[model samples]
Target: MAVITTKGVEKVYNPDKIPVKALKGVDLEIEAGEFTAIVGPSGSGKTTLLNIIGGLDRPTAGYVEVGGEDISQMSDNALIDFRKEHIGFVFQAYNLIPVLTARENVEFVMLLQNRSKAERHARADELLKAVGLEDKVHKRPAELSGGQQQRVAVARALAPKPTFILADEPTANLDSESTANLLDIMARLNQEEGVTFVFSTHDQRVIDRARRVVTLVDGKVDEDLRR
Candidate 1:
């Protein structure tokens, strides 16, 4: 089944004063359990498209469907709830709460969802182990290396068990080895757990690993290729 579908999607920044068209009638579909990458040069609307797809931003025109539900017209409050319930995000900067330990960071989302403390602890442990960070559970973001922190972030994003993960330049801050390790962990999750991943990145390393690639140029899809 298609987990995400975007049709005639368009986004315009400052429409009244100085309009900047970020996306222009873009169409795309991401199926369940697919590892897809959205690639483009800077100013090509990659981030804008990712934000829209994650329901962080709204489009000027067209529809965005996640699991067959239209999220295009949701109110700000409703959109927030929808995103918490269905989507996961991992950004370039690990974005972990510095005060929280690795395990606590991973458990944070489940805490927000009102999951029992026991359930949160179990899932956090499982996910951290999945990312190969079981030994660093008590470390804070400040104590961890860039790669370790990002791994923690990955575990945190998966805590809610969202329908899919939206990762934006997730390996941008890592060194070659760290990047490879992180990618391997994510790929394993995608394969073994049937987790869908949609990434927006300019990194060739990421594009090379993706099972499908969608290239955006000048706010439009220039090429869509499957490997």
Candidate 2:
């Protein structure tokens, strides 16, 4: 079964006014354990697609199914719960809580899920170690470099062991070396842990690492290439 599936997805903004269509009948299916990238020039609706798949936005038409469940019809609260349990997100900005330490940041989601303190601690430690942030577990976001913070974000995103990860322009703020390091860690996780990752990125570095590339143009799919 596909980890994520979209059929005839469409989105429109300001329907009462300008009605700018963001997605025009998009259809896609992402299998489990696939490392895929969605690429397009500006205003091509890549982010819109990712947001719909991530459950942050609802499509105006069609459906989105994650792990065989149709999410387009879910209530807002249901979607929130569904996202918490199934989808991991890494944004261009680190989005770490400034006051929380790296370990705390990683544990926050588990805490929300009402996991026991011991379980949260153990999982946070393991994920931090997995992301190569073992030594900086106690550092706050302000104390870490941009790359370090992004690494912590990755660790936090993985803490829940979500079915798949959604990353949006994740390498945009990093230097070459940091981007390489982050990509290496993600690749390792994808290979060794069989984690599925879908990214919307413009960076060539990220595009180079993707095993499959889906290109969008003028709110529609233009190309889907598997390498």
Candidate 3:
């Protein structure tokens, strides 16, 4: 079954006034464990589409189904619960809490899920190690480098054992080497853990790594290519 599906999805900011249509009749599907990248120039609808798919925003028209469930039909509270259980996110900003240690930041998500303290700690530790940050577990975001912080963010995103990960310009802040390392880690996780990865990126490095690339132009899908 398709893990993510969109049917004629449309997102308009202003209905009465000049409507800024961000996503226009977008229909797509993402299979489980697929590493898909939505590539486009700035002002394209890539991020908007990603946001809709991840339940960060609602479409003005049409529908989005994730993991066989129609999110458009869910209540706001139910969508929030669905997100907590099914979706993971990584942003270019890292978005890690400055005061929390790397491991603590990862554990925080599990804590929110009401996971046992021991289970949270163990899972967080394992994820940190998986992201190659075992030594930096005790270090706060300020103490870590940009790449290390992103790794911590990745671990935090994965702490809940989420079914899919949605990353937006994840490599935009990283240097070439750091981008390589981060993408390698995520790619390996996709292969090994069967975690679906969908990213919105303009970076050529990210495009090269994607198994399938969906090109967006002016809020519409222009091309879908498989490598």
Candidate 4:
């Protein structure tokens, strides 16, 4: 099943002023459980496309369907709620709360959903273990290594049981070993738990691990190769 679908997607910034066309007519589909990488040069609109698909930003024109819902047509508040329920985001910056422990950070999203305290704690523990951070559960972001912090970020993203994960340069800050470990964890999750992942990355390490590579150039899909 196609978990994510984009048709004729376009993004234009400052349309009334100096317009910057970030994306132009992008058509793509990502099936469930696929490990896909959206790769391109700096100006290739990879981030723009990811943002649109993830509902973080709306497109100038196009249709975006995530988990079969037309997110492009949703209101800002609606989009926000939709994202919380369906999309998981992992940024390059390991955006964890500096004050919260790994377990607390993982429970944050479920808290937003008004989940029971017991449910929240249980899920957090389960995810922290899944990411190999069971021992670091009580540690704060500042107390963990860069790799461990990213692992916590992953666990947090997965806390909501999102339909798919959208990661933007998730390995940009990690060392080689950290990147490898993170990738191994993600690949295992995809295979073992049937998680779906879509990444916008420039790292060759990430590209090498992706089962499908979609290349974009000058705001359009230049090549799409599936391994």
- What TM-score against the true fold does each predicted structure earn? 0.98, 0.98, 0.97, 0.98
Clashes of each: 0, 0, 0, 0
Encode model 3's per-residue lDDT on 126-159: one tens digit a residue: 9999989999889999999999999998888888
Which pairs of residues collide in candidate 4? none
**What would you estimate as the lDDT of candidate 2?**
0.94
Give the whole-model CA lDDT for all candidates, comma-separated.
0.94, 0.94, 0.92, 0.94
Misplaced by over 4 Å in model 2 are none
Give the poorly placed runs of model 1, Cα more than 4 Å off.
none
lDDT of 4 by residue, 48-143 (tens): 999999998999998999878899999999999998988888989999999999999999989999999999999999989988888998999999
**RMSD after Cα superposition, model 4:** 0.8
lDDT of 1: 0.94
TM-score of 4: 0.98
Show model 3 residue runs off by greater than 4 Å: none
Please tell me which model should have the higher TM-score, number 1 or number 3.
Answer: 1
Cα lDDT, model 1, residue 139: 93
